[model samples]
Target: MPIHNADIAAIFEEIADLLEIQDANPFRVRAYRNAARTIGEYGREVAGLLANGEKLPKLPGIGADLAAKIEEIATTGRCRFLEQLRSQLPPTITQLLHIPGLGPKRVKMLYDSLQVQTLDQLARAAQAGRIRELPGFGEKTERAILEAIRAHASQERRYSIALATQYAEALIAHLRRAPGVKQAVVAGSYRRAKETVGDLDILVTARQGRPVMEHLMTYDEIADVLSHGDTRSSVVLRSGIQVDVRVLPPESYGAALHYFTGSKPHNIAIRKLGQERGLKINEYGVFRGDERIAGETEESVFAAVGLPWIPPELREDRGEIEAARAGRLPKLVELKDLRGDLHVHSKASDGRHGLRELAEEARRRGFQYLAITDHSPRLAVTHGLDAKRLSRQMDEIDRLNEELEDIRLLKGIEVDILEDGSLDLPDDVLGRLDLVVAAVHSHFNLPREQQTTRILRAMDHPHFTLLAHPSGREIGGRPPMDVDMERIIRHARERGCYLELNAQPERLDLTDLYCQMAKAEGVLVAIDSDAHTLLDFDHLRFGIGQARRGWLTAKDVLNTRTINTLLPLLKRTM
Candidate 1:
């Protein structure tokens, strides 16, 4: 089997979890966890580098030891360190970590105190009211564990877009290199840029001698070949994502891509249109009484149905077809349309780079401006800055502005919205910044009314410029806070404040639906990186994906404007 970066990363993550449960050195555990993160986010496959006899790039947090382990796992499809850790602990205990609110410490506590080794055992203990008797596991904790177990049991596994892209791109590259292969493209939700993908559908066109199916089976990453044939094949990658590849004639490639890249309802609706036009559409091609009409390209397929080619991101049966028919399809926001990032962090508050490095990187990326919204003191875990530290950082930013030539660094703070709906820093401190991004750092479990009111109150602050991660969600890990988002969006419009579409893969907050809601209300949304490190700036692409799906255009985004225009709009909030 070919070891994917995700596969190696998963092993390292498991090793870290087991080591933490065994009470290993904190630095040792951190090293493994950080290596996993670095490898998981890395753009290229580590195995490919090793295959070409190239030295692995020195990834962040990966030292010699971790790099050696990555090579070993890539070559052998197993991590001896993880295996050794499993020997010292119950391998099943690692599964407990999947339950929300259960960390390694709590898992260890459950194992030592109650012998809860599996989800079933933990669920039974919680139901029997035994978990509450354990130290730190109160009734609320026990109840939460039960709920998490239920949710986990019922949820289908989905891969994050970043991870999915790693696999999809590697596979596409491999297939394109196959002899006689004319074209290959990843379809389905991966092409649609969905936040999470259930699987990948690859459509390809090849000559008679190409044997794409055979080539797929030869891939190094195939963990299990479920089936293989002359024209179709299915396999599960080591990282647990299923891939299905279909070979089609060049004539039908476009129709096949359209058929498979569907949002089910969208495809059904399109087929209905075909029926109304006295045409039949399928993976084969668009036919009028067995006479192939159009299928050579996606545009031809759409044109056959009297509609313009809709962007895949908007093909969610969300009025896209109607818009296409009426020639009103939006020119969706693209990554290049962004003029700057409004929420960025530096070493002043838990970020990895300094002000100069951040500014240089932003300038290198062609951004006209970058906001240094370091965390406020309320988030102590991140060593968030107080007024004194923030003031000093502001002074440094001003000095850098004078030194730097191309990029302007705006002074800002990601101020915490306290439980009582108050801003973390005093008004005097907040008033001095170019922008104030209010966020809820704690108390995620507040009642919907309380959460909504708390956020509204914070937005009412005269200095408040934007709401960061308007919905406090962490994708699969944590659900969005119980807040009335409609009310929040309305209040933001009335207050002249903006909302954020945080680009971090884990927190694509202000979801696609909410982005449309904000747009509908005539409220500008800022697609921000909320970056803690330099590499995080690259995550803006994911935010752009979300915005495009929400039907956002350049005009609907706040950061698309130049600094001069953006400053005036931000001042309107003040």
Candidate 2:
């Protein structure tokens, strides 16, 4: 029986966090954590289906007890084991599960000795010297925790797929060129083009022994090397990143890559399909008896089981196999078809580059135009513009238009949508800007209904042009506000509002599904990188993937339009 998705995953995640806090086996914790992620990538309501007499743990990581909890979740919508484990502790302690270094052991010790659970309480304890007092926890460890907490607060958790892609490309380039390297490629969530990536994993083909071992020792960014086996290497980068690379023979490259590029559930389904067909698959190629048959590429692996090619991102074993067999794969969007970015900041606010410099950058990227959307006056922290300030910036853009040759700057403002569901500026103020990007700033804890109503009401405001990072999700740590994304997309379409594909790595907010639905419903998609710094600008490639995944075409993006064309569309927003 396949371990039902939710049960096995929940147990694994909790167990990993608990074990980490317990200071137990680091590898065991990592194994469970990785397994949970691999299983969760399968896009289905797993626990629910398992209740209907399904095999549990057929998915990877479904050891007996973990599999049983999946059955529990499927049957009852909750896991008893997780509930029991946390029963004596304050619920807020669970949040520590997310903070990088303080695993289950540290958490338990803090709870037992200090009777503290929430981060606020723990911070106070650390300041008071309670953290250092714990046996085995030194001043250095305590300082590290405090630093991680602060970093955890400021670091963008959700990166745009584009940013992750850049890092992957940078890292892979080096790994591929290492001595004895044959073939190397990125696998895992990055390969699937997920909105956020915790780390990047690359697999390689190489000769065994000293060639691979020596090359492992030469990795530039490895802050700490963890393993150096004959054909496998694991290292932690200076950025707190753990990268695992394995080497295999050229003949096994295809099968090994397939096995390693797992949304574990997807791989399990593929394995099961092979079994049903009297074949087998592993790090070795697909085989029937002693005869090797296929698997040098994912396409061949799938073909062997009578399935069509599935996009790496969609290989979640989420009925993808059945869909492919039925010849019903959804058409995904591509970068070439996307046209422009709707949200951006410049020197008019907190952005580093000035108008001309920014415009030229856009031109280099082959963009037709850029929207000089400085921060609105409400965000004083950003040196946002008042009406007088706004007028001056608009004038500069007007002058730049006459002088600049290639790209044009569209007058725009990233206005704050106040809590009252009204935009920060009055209609008269908004009327002056060529385009308005209405966004929510402060309140993230509003009820789901109220949050939806607030954004919807703002969209109804005639001056609103686009919505940026609609859900306000930051990535791994912050969960997206519980808005009805489907509703937002539908309403935006009917109201003639454009939903932005914020190209910023931290907020690929309008996900592929939302963009797809919007396109279907006649809503325009604006794939903007929302670049703040110069380095951030190149991240548009990942945003292009999101647009492609959402089925966006050049016609869907506003940046694809020449300045002459984009102006009228902004005018229509008013």
Candidate 3:
């Protein structure tokens, strides 16, 4: 089986978890976790690099030992060291780590105290009132753990869009290589750019359906073929992602694409529109009394119903159908419209690269400006900068700007928002920077009103410019902080600050609905790449997708403006 970057990352992550549980060296554990992140976020497949006889690039935090492990896994499809670590721990203890609020340390504590190595074991202990008797876990914590266990069991597995894209694109490429396949593209929520995709709907226009279906079944990554037929096949990939491939005639391609790439509500609304127009629309095509009227293209399908073609991101029945009918659908933001990134990090903080390398990469990407917003001192784990250190970094940024051409590096800090709503850095230091990107780094479980008030107060800071990853979410790992997003958006409007659509795959904060709220409230949202490595600049596309899904236009995005235009805007916030 071909090992993907995600696979390599997963192995490294598992190793880190087991090592942590064993109370291994903290630095060693951190190195593995960081290496896993670098591998997972890398733009290219490490396995492909190895297969092509290339050396692994000097990845941040990845030393010789980790590199060797990556190559071993790539070649042999297993890591013996990880297997060794697994042998020392309860085999199922790692599954406990999947439960929210249960980090490796807590899992270790639970195992030591209650001998609970599985969810069933943990649940039984919790029910027996045994867990509450433990040192740190009280009655409330016990109840929360029990509820989390239940939630974890009932939840259907979903892959982050970034990881799903890796698998789906690889599979699509594999199918397209087959002789009879004319076109193969993934539809459904994947096409819609949903944050997490439950499964993939792949549509292919092929000369022979059987040949394409046969090719799909032969894919090296497939663990099981659920069903197979002339026109359709379903298979489960080793990653646990389910994919259904449908082979359709060329003429029905557009209609089928529309049908499957659905938010069911949107599809139903579109069908209702077709019905009212004396036409029937479905996966086959649009028909008027058994005669095919339109289906060859998405534009044709929409035109048949007296509407323009809707972007997949906007087809969520969130007034998109009405917007199309009125010709008021947004000219959604595109990746190319961005002139800069507002939130990026470098070696001075937890980020991997130096200023010069990051600047060169930004210029290579045609960005006119890139802001370096490393963490504030409050985030000690990131080795965040203090006032003195920030001054030195700002001085370096100034000196580098003089030597650099084409791209300008803006000085900034991702200052933490304290619990009492004060900015982590004092006003004098914050005022010297180009922008201040405030974020909530701790206290995620505050009540809705307290959280809302805290953020609103933080935005009131004189130099506060942008809110990075506003909701403090980690996609699959953590739920969005409970707060009134509407009030936050309105407060940004009131304070003249901006919001961020953080492009990091795991922190695509400001949910789509919240983005729309910001749009409606006249607050400009900066679609920022919150990039840590040079590869991270590529994440802006994911942010752009999220912006489009939120109905954001280039005008609604802060970074869409040129530096000359953007500086004035940033200045106003400061």
Predicted model with the maximum lDDT: 3
Model 1, which residues run further than 4 Å from truth? 19-32, 50-81, 138-140
Candidate 1 achieves a global lDDT of 0.89
List, in order, the clash count of every candidate structure.
Answer: 1, 33, 0
Candidate 3 stretches with Cα past 4 Å from truth are none
Show pairs that collide, candidate 1.
Answer: 2-220
Q: Order of candidates by lDDT, top first?
A: 3, 1, 2
Which has the higher TM-score value, candidate number 2 or candidate number 3?
A: 3
TM-score of 3: 0.98
Candidate 1 lDDT by residue in tens digits, 1-574: 5667888888988898899888888778877776776687676778878988998887655778898999899888888878887787889998898888888899999999889899999999999999999888899999999989998999999989978888888899999887679999999998898999999999989755337887777788788988888888889987789999988889998899999999899999999999999999999899999799999888889999999899999989999999988888889999999999999988776676788889998999999999999999888867799999999988988988999998999999999999999999988998889999999989998999999999999988889999999889898887899999999999988888899999988888889999999999999999999876677788999999999999999999999999999999988887
lDDT of 3 by residue, 1-574 (tens): 8999999999998998899888899878888988898898888888889999999998887889999999999888999998898788876898988787887888999988778898999999999999888888899999999999889889899998889988999999998987677778899999999999999999999767988887778899999889999899999999999999999998999999999999899999999989999999999899999999999788999999899999999989999988898989999999999999999999899899999999999999999999999999998889999999999999999999999999999999999999999999888999999999999999999999999999999999899999999999998788889999988898899999999999988988888999999999999999998888888888888998999999999999999999999999999988
Which numbered prediction scores highest in TM-score against the true structure?
A: 3
lDDT per model vs. reference: 0.89, 0.73, 0.92
TM-score of every candidate relative to the true structure: 0.94, 0.69, 0.98
RMSD of each: 2.2, 17.1, 1.1
Model 2 RMSD to the real structure?
17.1
